[model samples]
Target: MTEIKFYRVNDAYGYLSNFAPYPFEINGLIWSTSEHYFQAQKFLDKAIQEKIRRLKSPMDAALEGRNRENPLRSDWEVVKDDIMRLAVFEKFCQNPAIRRELLATGHATLIEHTKNDNYWADNGDGTGKNMLGIILMETRKRLKAE
Candidate 1:
């Protein structure tokens, strides 16, 4: 198998605008998207071993306030190092068992949702940004090529 170079997105602004990972379904509940996945794995779960310690919240004011130099940085930084260090997408894509489940029923078509859902990834036409869609598709293609 050819080596798959996973491209980690810039979380400098919360979820990376153009390269976020798509949501995958596990069990019956949907994971929503990669943002939620990162939060759950890298941010929320304390038991999960990570180089960067998880923050109390993504928008924890105290943490944000400490970084006066770059207030513009995404609140996701708390767990950013962990994600980057782990090369999360690469790990996520490599798992054949989980990948099979996600590919079988996960919603890869939709990117953007309604405004009430916070207009996430919307292209302003009710269509999702599909950022994760593009990344995952490319990953799948590369994985197949190998």
Candidate 2:
């Protein structure tokens, strides 16, 4: 089976990355990227959520979300995967071009290859959970079924 690995936004499968510039609307608000939505979700404060949403870049949103000064929601660890699934699903659903792009991959394995993140990516060596890639594939399946 063909394996598709993506990290940087410029890479061929970059659109599959949460950091890709695919804006999506959820919870009645527009998010700049899945990264922004995912990170912003860590907080329960409306101000912090708005702040992350308005950030200029996904990287900035990520860094801001990592600032422990803001308290993360108590259920973050338990609900994070569902949150990511919703974010990725909505991203592809709202963006037609990318939706097609995602479906075009067929049955190929999608991998978020990065060393910086062991949970969401493959840790650049296939040891990490690669949850993001798993979510993307699940999203693709849902999209296909719809």
Number of the top-ranking candidate, with lDDT as the measure: 2
Per-residue CA lDDT of model 1 for 24-88, tens digit only, reads 44434334334443444433323331211233333342233344443233556565544432333
What are the models' TM-scores? 0.35, 0.98
Which candidate number maximizes TM-score? 2
Q: Clashing pairs in model 1?
A: 111-128, 112-128, 121-129
The Cα RMSD in angstroms, rounded to one decimal, for candidate 2 relative to the true structure is 0.7
lDDT of 2 by residue, 37-133 (tens): 9999999999999999999999999999999999999999999999999999999999999999999999999999989999999999999999999
**lDDT for every model?**
0.38, 0.94
lDDT of 2 at 68: 98
* Regions more than 4 Å wrong, model 2: none
